[model samples]
Each structure stands twice: as C-alpha cells, then as structure tokens.
Target: MLRLLYVMTLTVCCLPLIPGLGGVLLSAASYLPALGLNEPNLDGWHAMTSWPGSGTALQLSLFTGVTATLLAILMTFLILQRCWGTQGWNRIEKWLSPLLAMPHVAFAIGFALTFSPSGWLFRLFAALTGETEPYLWSLVQDSQGFGLILALAIKETPFLLLMSLSVLKQMQVDRLLTASRSLGYNASASWLKVVFPQWLTKMRFPIYAVLAYGMSVVDVAMILGPSSPSTFAVLVWQWFNDPDLTQVPRAAAGAIALFVACFGVLLLYRLAEYFLVKGWQSWQFSGSKTYSLPGKYLFGFVALLPVIIIPVLLVWSFALRWRFPSLWPTRTTTRFWEQEVGNLLELAANSLILGLVSASVALVFAIGCLEYRDKYHKSVPQLVIAIPMLIPQLSILFGIQIAIYMLPGQWHVPATIWAHILFAFPYVYLALDGPWHSFDQRLTQTARSLGHSAWKAWVSVKLPIVLPAILLAWAVGLSVSFAQYLPTQLLGAGRITTLTTEAVSLASGQDRRISAIYGLIQAFLPLVFFGIALAASRIADPQRRLARHADKQVSSNELISTKPNH
Candidate 1:
C-alpha cells in the first residue's frame, strides 16, 4: 500500500512534467491538431522574436527579476545581521507569517494605492503644498518598471527572511557570531563574513523560486509594470489569450522562450554562487570592514507596510466620498460590502474550497512521499519536486492547457486543482522535511514491537509528534493555493473565480473600493488560517511536553541532592 501510494504521489507531483513539457514543445513547433496545423514549423518562434517590443519586454523581465532578487537577498541578509538574535527578532517573527501571507496581487495594489500619481502619498504632498491637484509623479505603471522591481523586492524579502530562520538555526549563528566577535569582527562584519555565505548556499532553492516568481509574475506586473511592452511573461499570457487561433503557436513559442530564460538565469545564478562563494577562498578570509545596514528601521518599515495598507484598503472599501488632499474619507458606509456580500460570499466559498482541497491533498501527498522514502529507502529528489516552483508557470501551464484541450471531457477544474497541488507540494514536503528528519523513530519502533502494526505505530506515535508541523504545512499550502492567480486564471477556463483571480482582475479596473474589498478579504482569509495554525501549533507543540519533563527531572534531581541523608 505504501509503495502504491508512493507511485500515486509520484504520478501527481512528478509525472506531469513529461506531458506538460511535451505538449508545449509540440505546440511551439506548430504541431497543433486542434488548430488543424499538425505540420511542424518554426513560424511560431519567428513570430515571437519578431514581435514588436519583444526585445524590450525580455530586457524588462531580466532586469527586474535579477535586480529584485538581489535587493531581496541583500535586504534579507542585512535584516538578519542586525536583528536575527536581538529582541527585535521576536517581533519580526510575529509579523513574518501575515506579511509572508500577503499575496503579490494585494501587495501590488497596496503599493499603487500608496505611491501612484493620485495615491495617498501624492494626496498628502498636495495637501501640504496647498495644491488642489495630485502630483503627476508616480511609481505605478512607470515606463522603467521601477515600481515592479520595488514591489517584487519587498514582497520577496519576508520569504527569504523566513527561510533564513531555518538556515540560521542550522548554522548555529550565535556561536559563529561569538567566535567572530572574539576575532575582532563587529556584528555587521561577523554576519557578512560568517553568515551570509552559508545562508546563500542553504537558500539556493528559495532564491531560485523567488527569481522565477519575479520573472514570471503576471498579475503584479500588470498592476505596477509598464504598459508599452510589459514583462515577457505578461506578453506571453496576453498572446495566449489572443482570439486568433494562429496566435496560439506564437504564445507557445513565447512560453518555451520564457522557460529557457528562467533555466538560463537559474544556471547563471548557480555559477555565480559557485564563483563568489566556493571558487574563491579569498573573500571568506578578507578583512572584516563592517558597514551597518539601517536594518532595524528598514525592517520596521517593511513590516509596518501591511499595517498601513490594510487600513487603507479597508477605508477605500467603505469610502462614500474621499477627495484628493484629504487625509481621511469624508464619509464611509458598508454599502460596498453589502452590495457585494453575496458575490463576496461566493468568491470566498470558491477560494476556501480550493484552498482546503488543494492544501489537504498536497499535505497528504507530501506525507505519502516522506513515508515512502522512509519505508522503501528511496524517493524522488528535492529538485524534481521543486520543478513546479522553479519553472515559469507560463511555460508549464501552456503545455498543460494544450493537453487539457486534447482531452474530450472537462478537465479545467481538475487540472487547476492538480496544478495547485503540484506547486504547493514542494512547500509542504520541505516544511515537513526538518520535522520528519528530527522525529525520533525509536518511539514508532517501540510501538511496533509492542504488538502494533507499522501503520498503527505511525498513527499512534509519529503523527502526534509532527502534528504541529503538519498543521503549519497545511496552512502554508492554503496560502499558496489562495495566492494562486495564474493557475486559476489559465486552467479554470474563465469558468471558475477565486478571490485571487477577482483581486487581480479588480486591480486593473477603475473601482478602487471594489478592488480594496476583494484585496482585503483575499489577504484576510489566508491570515485567518495562518493564525489558527500558529495557535494550534503552539498548543500541540511537543516542546511544551519536553520542557515540562525537564522541569520535573530538574526538581527531582535537586531534591535528591538535598536529601536529609546527605
């Protein structure tokens, strides 16, 4: 049964890549049976490269992706250097989950709300200057994509910071810091000289994920990116949506091109890491000239954004009248919420259903794979599992969509759910990786020895211990599914709508109140689940039991030492 289950898990998580890539290659080659163009040709590729502004779009993607990734990495490292072990770190941890849970769509919207020409900041500036009009200067939809880069950088920082936690713990950062300080290295120098390299190495996959995400991000780019050419991925998405059947091949070719771009960038990043960290030993031992980042303030600002954005969205959602240069809405009501209450409930239900189903299924598949590895002494590799996350969604989904059309029956809903699972599985598996490895197998062995079956032993012993991590992983999966915009948009065939899809769609519309309502709700649902997970994890944590056990042991040992006989 375990072997069978493992095979099923592999089928779900790994095997799809074959058909996905195959279908894409075929479509890119102009072998489209549905379009009656079964002959292989390179016309699609020709059209894609020759498309006006394709060069500019490609440059935008690369520049924005690489730059944002670098900034996020730098910010994450500096934040760690300044506050990883400090009291401020505790507060940062409290903020990480919700901040991490804020979807890119919502983040982009909030960013625009705060920084656009007619946004709140401009309003404030106009008010202070005694001007009746908003400023013409803006960040959103800039021709240079600075806004896109900024949003991507800030959004990815929290993720890198969270991943840094596990890496930092494993590196025993405190001891490293202590040794570095003894050698005359200051706090900044110690972190830079001692911790940054290790953190970078350990965070390679996450960095890759972020890079791919930044490069392929569609909704966020649409919200804040330039309109002239937009990002390459967005262009491909638009191409795929073209009503002309002949454009499908060109779109497929673009997807393949995007895949190549992501693959090349990831490879380049790997080589860079190798050269910077491993190929040269000089940098590791180089003089520790320290420079402090304004990390405390920077992180405070980054962490405080959601606190501000949420209220702004809330205020906009309820605003009946709010003019430029006014700090507060003149009037507010629940009319907007009330008007959309039914639609809101339906969207919420769809989102909840998708999140619950995908997260639960992904969690089970993750558990199965882990168990199979333990029982059979074999498993798929981490990279294979993470392929879904590392590759551009546009690339894989294009081919997957082709495959769906090849099928005679309705595959949209099933395919979307499967895509969500495939993407979320990597996170789920990695989340459980530490816990499952650290889990004491002896308890299970003891249970098995005392007349329990393997399954029974696992259920009675292993499950309880990892329950906290399991819940946490589930919460991660839920957020992942909730934040899915591309999969739902592409695979749902416009027949399905979730809060993420609606939020992204509304972001493009002129209705800020409606957009804010959706964005706020979209942010709220995932946060609720995450809050529950954290609270439940705390309640169920095995550490509490172990700590209590240690306290009793300490008391008994002290009592024995101070006995009257002594």
Candidate 2:
C-alpha cells in the first residue's frame, strides 16, 4: 500500500513536467494542431526573437537577476559573519519570520509606495528641504530596472539566511571557526577563509531558487520593474495575454526562451561558484586579512524596510485624502475597507481553502515520498523533485494551462489547487528532508519488534517524534501556495481570484488604498498559519526542554568560537 501511494505521489507531483514541457515545446515549435498550425517550424521562435525590444528585455532580466542574487548573497554572508553567535543573532532570527512572511508582491507594492518619486521618501525630503520640486529620478518603473534589482535583493536575503541556519548547524561552524582563529587568524578572516566555501556550496540550491525567481518574477517585475523594455518574463506574460490568438505561439516560444535564459543563468552561477570555491583556491588560502563589514547596520536596514513598508501599507489602506509633501493623511477613512470587506472575506475564504487543501495534500505526498525513500533506500533524485522549483513557472505553466483547458466540467478550483500543490510540494519536501534524515529509526524498529505493524509503528512511534517538523513543513507549503501569483492567474483563467491575483491586478490600477488592503491581507494569512505552526510545535512537545538545551549549547559554542582572541 505504501509503495502504491509512493507511486501515486510521483504521478501527481512529478509527472506533470512531462506534459507541461512537451506541450510548451510543441507549441513553441508551431505544432499546435488545434490552432491550425499543424506544421512544425521555427516561425514561432522567429516571431518571439524578432519582437521589438526583445533583446533589451532579455538583457534586463539577466542584469537584474544576476545583480540581485549576488547582492543578496553578499548581504547574507555579512550578516552571518557578524552576528551568528552573538546576542544580536537572536534579533536576526526573530526578524526572519516576519520578513520571510512578506510575499514578493506585497514587498514590491510597499517598496513602490515608499520609493517612487512622489512617494513618502520624497515627501519627507521635501518637508525637510522645503523644495516643492518632484524628485528628478524615478526608482519605480525606471528604464534600468535598478529598483527591481534592489527590491529582489532585499527581499531574498532573509530566505538565504533561513536556508543557511540548517547548513551552519550541520557544518559544525563553531569548531572550524575556533580552529582557524587559533591558527593566528581573526574571527572574520577565519570565517571568510574556512566557512564561506562550504556555506556557498551547501547554499547552491537556495541561491538558485533566488536566481530563478529574480529572473522570472512576473508580478513583482510588473509592479516595480522598468516599463520601457520590461523584463523578459513580463514580456512573455504580455505576449501570452495578447488578444490575438496567433500571438500565443510566439508567447510559448518566449516562455521557452525565458526558461533557457533562466537555465543558462543558473549554469553561469554554478560555474562562478565552482571557480570561487573549487576551481580557484588562492583567494581562500592567501586570505589572512579580512575587512570589517557594516553588517549590523545593513541587517538593521534590511529588517526595518519591511517594518516600515507594512505600516505605510496600513496607512494607505485607510487614507482618504493624502497629497504629496504631507507627512500624514489629511483625512483618513475606512471606506476602502468597508467597500472591500465583503469581497475581502470571500477572497480570503477562497485563499484560505486553497492554501489549506493544497498544502495538506502536498504535505502528505512529500511524506510518502520520503518514507518510500527511507524504506527502499532508493527514490527520485533531489534534482527531479526540485524540477517544479528550478524551472520558471512561466515556462511550464503555459503548457499546464493548455492541458487544463481540455478537461471537462468546472476545473478552475481543482486545477488551481492542483497547480498550487505542484509548486508547494517541493518546498514541503525540502522542509521535511532535514528532519526526516535526522530522525532516529530505532524508535520505529522497537515499535515493530513489539508486534506493531509498520503503519501502526509509524503512527505511534515515528509520527510524534517528527510532529514539529511535519507541522512546520505544512506551514511552509501553505505559505508557498498562498504566495503563488502565476499559477493562480494562468490556471484559473482570471475567473478564480485569490488574494495574490487580486493584489497584482489592483497594483496595476495604481490605487494605493485598495492595493495595500489586499497586500496586507495577502501577507497576513500565511503569517497566521505560521504562528499556529509555531504554537502547535511548542504545545505538542509539552516539554521542549531538550530542544531548548540543544539550541543553547549550539549558541554557546558559537559564541565561544567567535570571541576575539588576544
């Protein structure tokens, strides 16, 4: 039965890649029979490549993606080097959950509100300088996409930090740092020389995830990215939404091109990582000198950006009459809330239901796969499992959307939920991987020896031991589902509206009030689930005494290793 379920899990989560890719490839090659383009040819590819500003858009995507990823990585490393074992580290950890909770769209919305020429920052500057002139430069929708790059970098840093937590814990960073420092190296130099290479290698997937997102981010790019050329992903999105039916093949080709560009960028990043760590060693061994970074200040700014953005969102949601150069709203009203509250409840209900159902289903599938791997000592490779994550959503989603169109009856909700599950499963699997690997098998073995069946033993013995991780993984899946924009939009065909789709739609309307209300709600929902997960983890443990002790011991060892050597 377990083996059967494992097969089912793969069928549901992994099999779609076949049809998704095949469908897109077929369409890109102008082989879609239904549209009367039966001959396989390069016309679609020609159309896509020949489009105006196509090269510029592709360049923007590459530039913004690479720059943002590099900046986020550097920022993450600096924060870790400065605060890993100190009391400041606690604050960093505390800030991570909320920072991570803010969806990319919400962050982009808030970022636009805060940094745009007529935005609050300009108003504050005007108030200080008493100059009525609008700012000369535009960050939001600028031609260069610098704003998009900055926003992506700032938003992704916390995620990389979160991914690093397990790596650092598992790597025994404390001992390595201590050993390096004892060899007459300073703490910073020791970390730079010894720990960074390992951290970079282990952090490859998270960084790739960040890079993929940076390259193909549609909603956020739509909100804050340059408009003249737009990014490549946004260009593909526009092409897909074009009213002309013949243009869709071009869109399909564009999606394929975007996927190729993203894959190429990932490959480039891998090569850079190889050279920095494996292919090049002079930088590591020759480095006894390390310069101090303003990590505390940098971290403070990164953490505070979201904090500031949220309140601005709240104020905008309630503001009735607010003009430029005014520090606060002249008159605030809840009309937006009043008008949206009814629709908000419906959207929230839909979002909540979708998130819960998809996340729950994905969690079960992930656990089944993990258990299958453990039992058989053979399973799908990590790369196969991560296909959904590594591939650009725009690439496969177009094909998946077409496949859903062939299904009979109403499938918007199911198709949307299924799409959510497809994306959410990998995150849930990753969250559970560490815990499942670290879990003790003896507990289950002992239960089995006591005449308990495998299922019974798993239920009574293994389940309780990993309940916290399970709950957390469920929440992670929930969050991933909640944050989805493309899948919800494309698969639902705009008929089904979730908070993310709603937020992105409203953002284009340029109504700050309505956008903030949706953005706040979008960000708030997953946080509630995360809070519940944390509370449940504590409650389920009854006595988290051992966990607390282990954490303290880890922190103490880190602190001792990081202390300055006279």
* TM-score against truth, every candidate: 0.93, 0.93
| Range of the 10 consecutive residues with the lowest summed lDDT in candidate 1 | 287-296
Candidate 2 lDDT over residue span 135-224, tens digit each: 978789999999998999999999899888888988999999989888877878877889999999999888888899899999999999
lDDT of 1 by residue, 1-566 (tens): 77776777788877778878998999999998778997999999999999999989999999999999999998888788888877888999888888977877787778888888878878878888898877776889998898889888888999888877777777888999999889888888888777888888999999999999989889999899998989998899899889998888899999999999989999999999998888986877786566565677779877776778888888889989888888888998899899988999999999999989999998988888888888778876877777988999989887888888888999998999998888888888878877887787889999999999998998878887999989989998999999898889888999989999998888898788998888889888998999999999888877887898899999999999898882
Off by over 4 Å in 1: 289-293, 375-379, 442-453, 545-566
RMSD in Å for all candidates: 3.6, 6.8
Q: After best superposition, candidate 2 residue 163: deviation in angstroms? A: 1.0
Using lDDT as the measure, the top candidate is: 2
**CA lDDT, every prediction?**
0.87, 0.88
